[model samples]
Target: MSELIELFKDPYERRARLVPALLVALPLLVPLVCVYGPRNPILTAVLGLLGGCGALYALASVARGRGKKLEEALVKEWGGMPTTIALRHRDSTALDSVSKRRYHEAFSSKLGIGMPTAEEEAADPARADDVYIGATKRLRELTRGGRNLLLKENIAYGFHRNMLAMKPLGVVACVLGLAYGLIIAKALQLAPLTFAPGKIAAPGLAAALTLLISLAFFVAWVFYFDKDSVRRVGFVYAERLFECLPSLQPTMPRKRTTKSTASSDGPD
Candidate 1:
């Protein structure tokens, strides 16, 4: 866990994975907090114990793993990855054919590799996909940093992707919280609306608030997350990545090395 302490400083990890994780985790903790009381030393000690044992770190790691898997699944569901789709000549959703041509030329120049030709890609689409994946990886390495707009776009995509990945767990936490809240409210004989003058205990009010919060989170997950939105963010990130091409210094073209050159030069 101490070795992973540096991970805490990574903005991508915190904002994209840890924050959503905590949102899901917090609702689950509400019931415990209610039972133990907010200022209870016992509750504080247990939290400390969990933190010391690296539970929170593990949760983030697990969430990140799931997010990655889900992202890959999404890419498959969408026919191809955003970057790959951008590189493909056939994917009109990615870019106009002329723009894609320009993009491929720039990428070939900057990345110091041959961009897949439409004819070649048509013959071997899988190989073309490999080339696109490699180019995207190189681009990411070249543009990695806080100041880069591409990195910001990457963070944005990651946040949405992970939030969607954590949606099921979030829903579970919301359900648990809502169930406990409703039970507590029913036991206390509290009405959601007051038709006449009635006093609600502090606990009843707290339970009702918890129910409302849980419902809000459930609604957000239901409405705000889906395949289309995630794909949109992915495309935006891919475009931002491609836009970094101009920033990279172009690689020198490889010189021709043919048998004719060997014959033209004096033998060593």
Candidate 2:
């Protein structure tokens, strides 16, 4: 438990932003050059290079944003006492007794009050144990119920991570664009199709353009929708943790007893 607390105290490690950006841009540029040439293959290739750069820029932005958000959310949740306890025991009830006891001792000790005797401590690890189990139990239950909801958020975050990692949509767009350019160049070679007299490669060019546009839309969806899922999850978890804070603090009421006096009635 101490180790877990220590671990949560450390700053989070984030990946370099450059890596994902480079991956997205490199493949995307290949298709760009093939589609937009200056009638000179060399010049066309140069233009195509821009595609890679754009993809890289977009992917890098997504990765950096998601990574930062995830780190911040985790820190917020684990940095506090109540949230930390909830997360630490999100899985099992084994630590309930120990955690309750430790919290109780810490509270009493901090207030400069005498610690309960071993026998009294052993009698009930909860109420007398210094820590209130009712509140902890309530927190534990809230955390458990929220687990599935948080999991969905985690999964959404993961998908965004993969999108940043693989840059799949960007690669697909580049490939489709390249295919269309090649098809147009092939059709132009067979015979001059008089669509626009000079626009003989229109069909193939259109396909490639459509593919690039589709990829752009997909990327937007990933950024706006998928990324938001992770943020929402973090928000909910933080809120729940805050709700459990009162219970984490020990609230011991003073024990009160009444003294009785017997009255004598004139020898009855």
Candidate 3:
């Protein structure tokens, strides 16, 4: 959790988190103020909370994005490795080999892993492979625990994005449902639609209930149908990138050859 908070401390992350909250909150405030602000500050505030609910998901997305960047930054900071090798396998990049080489050199220098020699590369390819593979493996091990956390964050953010997109409809539905219920209650004088020690009439229960139901429906849709599809897209991208890591690739077993087959397999 502390790590998650630290991730959002970045300026880019803060922007990602804050923009969505403001987008959801501002429009929500207008209606709450116009309708209930004059009559009941308490109810208006409760509605205000619901209005900005989508912000939580946006912040979550920012955390995942930040975590991903931090994961790469750590690997580079440790050994000057390019974590993009894995990510680039699935994602597109326009960087040329020269730029990648220069970046790797500078990155390694900052981390105190001086440049390797052509003699070293040619003379001991296996040793160089070990070094690179170890670096990549360390990175994966460091990030493995956070994989589920990041996936949950991404999946949740997708759901929140859907909810925000449906906000106009949800808000309208809640308002209309409340209005209709109140009309019926008032006409039938259904228990005065109020309950308190004094004459303080609380009018937002119906709206709150309606909003709660809408939220539940949205959550269900995300969990049952939408989450799997969204998860698959994220999984595919991550899997492809992870596969690019040397240590993550699978090794195939060599087939045993019969004596006759072995004789035939020898060079002419």
Best by TM-score: 1
Order the candidates by lDDT, highest first.
Answer: 1, 2, 3
What lDDT is reached at residue 257 by model 2? 19
Tens-digit lDDT track of model 1 for 147-219: 4566667777777777898989888888888776666665433356322213224446667677777888888
Cα lDDT of model 3 by residue, 1-268, tens digit: 4544543564333443444334334334444554567889888777657535544545446444443444344434433223323212122242445544553343243322333344664575445434434433433443443455434443344333333433444455545444443442242234555523221143355434434444454444335433234334333433433333332333332111101211000010
What local distance difference test score does each model get? 0.71, 0.40, 0.39
1-268: candidate 2 lDDT, tens digit per residue: 3432332342111124434444344434444444444356876655446434453345545665655555545445544222223323231332355654554454343322333444654574333322322333333433443445443433344344434444444556545544444455453333454233344335455444544554564555356434344344434443433334444444444231111121100000
Winner on lDDT between 2 and 3 is 2
Worst 10 residues of 2 by lDDT: 259-268
Each model's number of backbone clashes?
A: 0, 5, 1
In Å, residue 64's CA in model 3 sits off its true spot by: 5.8
Q: List candidate 3 segments past 4 Å from native.
A: 1-14, 45-92, 114-268
Best model number under lDDT: 1
Q: What lDDT, from 0 to 1, does candidate 1 have?
A: 0.71
